[model samples]
Target chain A: MNMLRRHWPWLLVLVILLAFPFLFYDWTKGRHSGFVLTLMSEIGVMAIFALSYNMLMGQAGLLSFGHAVLFGLGAYCAAHVVNMVKAGTIWLPTELIPLAGGLGGLFFGYVFGWLVTKQRATAFAMITMGLGELVSAAALMFMAFFGGEGGITIDRVMDTSLVGVRYTSPWQVYCLVLAWAFIAAALMRLQTQTALGKMANATRDNFERAQFVGYDPRMVRLMQFTLSGFFAGIGGGLYVLIYEIVTFDTVSAAKSANALLAVYIGGAGGFFGPILGTIVVVLLQSGVSLLSNAWLLYVGVLFIVMVMYAPGGLIGLIFMHLPIWRAGRMRELLLPYARAFPPALLVLLGFVFMVELASFTTIGAAQGKRFTIGGQLIDTTAPMPWVIAIAALVLGALWLRHEARGFRQRWDELMEGSKRAQATAAPKPQEAVA
Target chain B: MEVFVVSLLNGLVYGMLLFMLASGLTLILSMMGVLNFAHASAYMLGAYFAYTISQYIGFWPALIIAPVLCGLIGAGIEMWGLRRVHQNGHIAELLFTFGLALLIEKGVQMTWGLLPVPYRVPELLDFPLFKIYGTQFPAYRAFMLLISALMFGAIWLGLTRTRIGLVIQAALTHPDMASALGHNVPRIFTLVFAAGTALAGLAGVIGGNYQVTEPAMAFTMGPIVFVVVVFGGLGSLSGCFIASILMGLIQTFAVVFDVSLADLLAKFGFVVTSSTPFAEILTVTLPRIGALLPFLMMVLILVFRPRGLMGTRDT
Candidate 1:
């Protein structure tokens, strides 16, 4: 009963994942679901990548900018193995290629982590950046392993299977991604409960204190980084399996930045934060980019807002609501929250309108494209549109501030009340897991 | 000999330009413990601002106005944006600047369009200053030298002579002590950040035309400046200067030379072909691989001398 209670969420998640393709089958029929399948596989890949990154940034507190190097290296190694399979040289099943990638990741991680783990904080960040740049540059320069600018491309159809499953369809590739991602995520989660993981956290909290406890802080850091690399490598193997092509972009700073964005915005403090963040970022990348070119700007703005206002990220914000729920006062603040929501949204829309106007006037006009929303064409040269944009921006900002002030007051009151209630009643469980 | 001298001179000029950017960055990094990823954004802003101001009031006046304008923007960012996010710690500050960089990049692109602005050297200084053997060095290069040197002097004098400079020096070296002495450390941070950005702006005004005034100039110059700062060691101006010059010279002189490791190995009668380990990497010439040198140097330094060259404090 205890095991079932504890593990039910995992089972539920597994069921949902298994049902995902079937659920989208009616909507994404024929040639289109290839897109959906690819997108889903990408999510799985990014989730594993981001979760691994969160191990460093969130749990271990080691910020690495060159993490994608491990991922890319893994993919490249797997690509070689794939080619070897095609040539009938190595007799390993297709399912075992990712293990080869994991071994490659571990080897590189052990070598690189030795040098990097000697430093901490800002110095670590710089070293990782330098490392990232070196690898990325090398990936472009060397054609033997990296395959130069065209990157290493290979056929995945080797007719080799471990469990009688053909690896031809995108759906089959996605299932592989899903299985590996789940296994990798579960392993990483299990890592958090280990003594090494505890030591890593200890090192992050206070290096001196961890040392006082007779642990070499450097070794702890090295272990965490190397282990994180192992997971990231598995993610990369999945990447090669899904796309069948891995380029220098996989090892670029931008790719590393994607992990940083996902981890931070998802709430680096939570185990599942990066997982959630990965999904949202991929969704935004696919959905928002199709609609507008300013998707990056929006993501940047959102990231900054999250960093400034909610240091805990989306998960952190959700966690903050726990006290109110436990205190049974969730409904009391709903009305105030609703009142604050529209003005906040209006403020966002106003800024978007202004940004779109500026972007349209400069870039859109140059490209000879008209800015249209809901079939209404926006004339950038017109004074009325400009005035409307400005008014919406400035006025909405002012109104948001007013509503925000009221919201803050109510929020503080409710939070304070919850705290008092908790004090007066039985003491609530302390949040120690993170 | 002429190649050596010319390359050396070119290196010095390039180094000085890098110093203009790195100097401000080193200060912010040392004092705030924030890498200021947006530091390069300030340089780009300076160029764009100079380009706009130059269109209105010509190049000479634009140089002064653009830097001052950048300083104001830096001040605003520090006071409003960074200050608010300070409680969340250094990572938040870094992310804040990263976000600011994105916003400013988009803002610049929106305002100035995607293409490079036609920001040219003034007609007054457009002539060649010196003829090295057969090569003509532009008078604008000399002007860049003069401006950068003056900046170095001004910065030196200001820090040594002025009251605010002493406070900054104390904060740079002993931040906790400075803060405990009731010296309003936050205000000092604001001042340092603004001054650093102003220096970046100045670099942009002079160096922009030398390079090119474009939106992408930030990313190009950004990492190179960071390399200079790191190579020179953290929190040391003298070190920053030496490293900048060294990097500048290396990059320029590297372009002059066309030799590769493979060639050197073959000189010793070892004919390593494409099948040899790291053959592609070894066969790549110095000029082609010059861009990799700084990163290689950075890794080497961090590994052997983590404190950097001539650094007093460990980073």
Candidate 2:
């Protein structure tokens, strides 16, 4: 009980992770469906990638638009290692192959970081973008190394294992991935406590002040960037091990954007922000992509919304509610929630209809399909559906605005009451609920 | 010699096309401090719009209407989307633009399908305008050069001769100071963004048929345009012009002069037999790396001269 109380968060996380596969397996009736496991593995890899990105963006204040160079290099190098092992040149454990990727990433980071670290802010971003483009183009040009557009693929069933296991199972791979993810996360956590990490934060907060304090901001940024590259490389190596393919797309600007999206959407300030972001992003990617081809448009819209309304991210929004929730004021806001529900639902339904209408007009029209709505097949060729969708969108938006103002007003009143109650040292059950 | 002249003229045409795209991007980037990743997507949209419009209307009408539509889209994006994101800082704004680019590319694909749209040169401009020895120069290429030159002159005059242009020029160097001086910085940003996107759209209308108007066109042209902008520096139109020309010439001339390291070595009495490990590397020619040269130049320029050719700022 004492241990549980002391490390409750860690215990809770561990329990959830371990219990996930079993719960999913039960839900699917033990069909050997490995979708959740695969998704979790992807989350694990991307979590590391997003964390590494944050190490530069959040800590060093260096906005890198091309961090995928390290990740892709690591993947390519790992692919080569897999090939070498398959060729009987060396025998190594499957789990340790990602270390080769880390080494490859470290090597390139040192070289590229040397040149890139000289510039700051926008210059750094532009230079990194240039380097990224340079490498991706070179990857396509050099067919020997990059394998051109077709990309390079290696079989993971090498039959050589340190533990003498054939390593054929997805569950086995998942275990290895989880172990590495935990180790990487622990190391990253430890890194946050180091002097270099502190200096990185100092540089991010105010470079001029850090320089006045006798620390070179550029050096701090470079070191953080290189280390971030190393971790990203580890993720890349894991990527190859999971998918067994390395392509130019792996290191393209799009991949860098993916990391940026994950980190920003998750929240940059918190340590576990990237992990949360990776989970949300990977889930949305897998789930939404299956449902709609316009997943990217939705993602773009969501990102724009996040950038505008919620700069701190989903996690930040949750954290923002903590103080109010802890004061037992959340109970009082149930009335506002009830009042807000109809308008929110109407807005959501209207928005979904608009998106569907747009998708039907473009993608569905191309496929030569008609949209069915409310027990009637609607002709997508007609402008009536479009008119209705636009009307619904406008009306719903107006209603949502009105409801949102009311919700805000009610929330403010509850919060004021909660603050007053807190000041009087009331024995609030809200803290326990929180 | 004839091939050289043809290549030079071709390079000049391509260079001007690139300048049409890069100049607007450079201006927007320098003025707003936002590297709009969707700039090339706007170009792609322009091409698609022109192609669709030309199919119904005429080419000239399409050219005029498509760029105007692109400018409206740009203005709308800046006012509603980018303005909202600007508060989060540059990185967020950049990411927003990146997402916008992806969405635009996908949206273009969704609307136009995956195939390349057949946007052809007008009948009036389809014939050869001049000949160099046996090589002929198309009237379309000449038209492109003329339009780009006119645009360059107009931009130069607008910046130097007009009050708004002077304020924009000042913003290019000192955006904070311009804002402090009571200029409507936001309005200026929107105007610059709209103008930049219009230029990109114009490039698309001209260059679409010159190249290929495809879904993959944005990806192909986006990086190269970025390379030109970065290599040209942040706020210098002169640098942008020079870099665009340099990139175009390098890409064109490289394709014209197809010589490999192995060929050079062979001229020096060096021979390599078959089944050699280094033979593949030795066989790499400049022409084969045509797509990579501009980016290589960018990296070299960034490393050696961080401020670029005529850039006053570090970017």
Candidate 3:
């Protein structure tokens, strides 16, 4: 009962995730929005990808600029495997395709890890970047495996499912993705409790100390990298199933950047951080991108802001408020938060305004896109909108600065109170255990 | 012989331009321990800024102004952005710069549009400077060479001769002690960063017209510059210069050479065919694999010599 009570939130989240697509269901057509389903499936695949990335950045203290190499190669392997199954050269259940990808990832990860694990920190990052470039270049050059620029295509409905479900529809595919996501996430979570995971943490904090404790730091790194690759490969397998085609772009620096962005923006401090980050990143990519050409600009600014201010990420911010909530002083900061919201919103709107205006002036003009607000078109050539945007940005920034000071003061007070209460409520220590 | 001479000259011009950019990156990275990922973005900005400015005044004034503007922007980023993130650690600082690179790319696209700008060579330098056997070498290439050489000489002199240069060197090796000695390390950091970015901008001013000025120029140039830096080793300007030149020659000559591994192997009585296990490796021409060479060299250099050639310390 206690365990159930403690884990109820996870159950709630799962229910929410399952119910989300139905919100956009078309009853008349008896189907889900292809766009929404695909977007959600993308989120699922990317969530797994980001989590795998965290196994390096968050757990092992390794920053990779080319994680997509593992993901991409695994995808290529899976694509080839599917084609083979279709050709009757190989026999495998549809559900087991991701395992083949995992094996592929493990193979490459082991090979590449041998080269990269010799170095640590900045050198490792540089080497991985070079490796990423080399592989990407090879992907374009070698037409046999990577299928040149046209890429490799496969049919997902191979009719070889162990569970006897032909994965023809997006719904079926999404369900498979969900099941796999859960399995991968749970396995990854359990792995963190293992000795290797703890040792990986130890090395991350202090490699020399870890070495003193009779562990090879390089070995620890290699193991972590290989395991991470396995999970990332599974994500790549799902990608092949959904998209039906895998291209050189899958292995590109930009794809690696996607995983990095998701991990960083979501916060690398906690287990659920990358998942949170993946959702936000995917939404911004799919949703916000449809609304504006300057979506990349917004994502960039957000990333910078998070790095500068909230390096702990969204989860970290939430965790910071935990003590106050426990102390029942969360209500005290409501007023300050309310005061800060308007200015923050104003600043965001103003920034977006300027970006849109600038974008419309160049890219928009070429595309014949006029800037609009609430069904009313705003002239790009006009000085009025520019002045308003500038005014809002400048004024809101100043206002936010003022409100931020108040919020900080209130926060510190509440946090100090929480600490004091917890200290006083605890039993005092005996002098000599008499 | 004509191809050899022309390729050498072209490589020299390209290498010098790379040095102009990579030197600044080398200094900033070594001194600050912050890899300024936006270094190439500054180069792109310099190109776009020069293009716009040239349209109004002329290329000469644009050359003088664009780099200065980039320098000022670099100073602002260091003071406002980098200084604030310095307390967070190197990873945070790196992420900050990475985000800045993305933002700058988007910003450039928004301002300049998606198309390449017509940032042409001035009429004075448009004509042929000399004939190489049968082909005429453009005077603009000669101008690029002259400017890069002058800048290189100036940088070498400044670093070895000037008092500020001595101070910078002291700080680069021992920042905390330099701080304790009351030399204002933060200001020096800002100065170094600005100077480095300005150097990149100068390269952009020359290189943009030499190649093409577009949004994608930064992405294309960014990785190759990094390859040069890594191959040369971190914190070594001379190494950077050498690596740049070597890479420049390799890339230029690789395009000229049509020899494949298969052809070399055939001389030793080894045959590569369609049925071979690694036929792609044997049959691919040097020119076909030109893009892979620099990265291959970087990876090999990193694997064999982590300190890089002439590098005084480990990265």
Task: Please write out the lDDT profile of model 2 over residues B1-315, one tens digit for every residue.
Answer: 888888899899999999999998999888888888899998999999999999999899988999999999999999998998888888778877887887888788778876787789999999998878977889999999999999999999999999999999998888889999999989999999999999899999998999999988888898889889888888899999999999899999999788888888899898755576678778888888787788777878888898888887778
TM-score: model 2, chain A: 0.91
Clashes of each: 0, 0, 0
Q: Candidate 2 at A434: error in angstroms?
A: 21
Q: For model 1, how does the per-residue alpha-carbon lDDT over A383-433 read when each residue is reduced to its tens digit?
A: 998888788888888988998898889999999999999889975567554
lDDT: worst 10-residue window of model 1 chain B: B306-315
What ranges in model 2 sit over 4 Å off?
Answer: A1-6, A26-31, A159-164, A365-378, A413-434, B265-279
Query: In CAPRI terms, where does candidate 3 land?
Result: high
Model 2 chain A scores worst on lDDT over the 10 consecutive residues at: A425-434
Q: How big an interface RMSD has model 3?
A: 0.7
lDDT of 3 by residue, A1-434 (tens): 87677669867877888899999999999998889889989999999999999999999999999999999999999999999999999899999898888888888888999999889899889999999999998999899999999999999999999999999889889888888898899899988999999999999999999999999999999999999999989999999999999999989999999999999998998999999999999999999999999999999999999999999988898899998998888888889999999999999989999999999999999999988899999998899999999999999999999999988998888989999998888764665523
Per-prediction fnat: 0.71, 0.61, 0.84
Please identify model 3 stretches exceeding 4 Å from their true place: A1-7, A427-434
Candidate 2 displacement at residue B200 in angstroms: 1.7
Question: B1-315 in candidate 1: lDDT tens per residue?
Answer: 999988888899999999999999999988988889899999999988898898999998998999999999999999999999999999999988888887788788888888999999989999988899988999999889999999999999888899999999999989999999999999999999999999999999998899988878887787788788888888799999999999998899889899999999999999979799878878988988788789889888887887889777777
User: What C-alpha lDDT, on a 0 to 100 scale, does residue A425 get in candidate 1?
Assistant: 92
Candidate 2 structure quality by residue, lDDT tens digits, A105-202: 88888889988998888778878988898888778878888999988898888877677666576667777778778778878888999999999999
Docking tier of model 1: it is medium
For model 1, report DockQ: 0.75
